[model samples]
Target: MSYVDGYVLPVPKSNIEKYREIATKAGKIWREHGALEYRECVADDVKSGEVTSFPQAVKLKDDETVIFSYIVFESRQHRDEVNAKVMSDPRLNDMMDPKSMPFDGKRMFWGGFSPIVEL
Candidate 1:
């Protein structure tokens, strides 16, 4: 089974373009380091639900929206190896700063998932 890392977060409407630019660079780096896929998606039809939903996951604000993204890896070990290289890559230096981010890092949520089932 593949390993995955998921991320959901809010980005100011005005920062969407900049966010895409950053994500593009990061995605390339991840793929080069062995990630099977690095996908990013902006909320297209998110709506509030009874308890919690994608909209609520990032505490969607009036001026901001959610970005749901994921990265697929061959396995946990591959993820660790690839990420270590991506993190150390000089090409990603500018992205390491919170101030340069298009979204609020404080509100971002992410985690690695071990695949239990996959068809």
Candidate 2:
């Protein structure tokens, strides 16, 4: 089964384009370093829930939208290897600064998952 790393964040509407540019560059770096797939998606049909939802997950605001992203790898070990290389890649240096990001890095959440089923 493939291992996956997923991310959810809230990006300001005014900064979506900038976020996209950064994500594109980051995605390319991840792919180049052996990520099987890299995808960044903006919220289109999501809504804030009473208890929990994509919006609530990131404490989304009126001026912001949710971003859901994921990266696939052959396995946990493979993901670690790829991420190690990605972290050391010089091309990502500019994007590594939290202060320069288009969104609130403090609110961003990410996790690794082991797929139990794929069909």
Which model scores highest in lDDT? Answer: 2
Candidate 2 clashing pairs, residues 3+ apart or interchain: none
Candidate 2, 1-119: lDDT as tens digits: 99999999999999999999999999999999999999999999998888899999899999999999999999999999999999999999989898899999999999999999989
Error of 2 at 63 (Å): 0.2
lDDT of 1 by residue, 1-119 (tens): 89999999999999999999999999999999999999999999989999999878778889998999999999999999999999999999999799899999988999999999999
Compared with the true structure, model 1 gives a TM-score of 0.95
Q: What is the Cα-based lDDT of residue 67 in candidate 2?
A: 94
What's the TM-score of each model vs. the native?
Answer: 0.95, 0.98
Q: Which residue pairs clash in candidate 1?
A: none
For model 2, what is the C-alpha lDDT against the true structure? 0.96
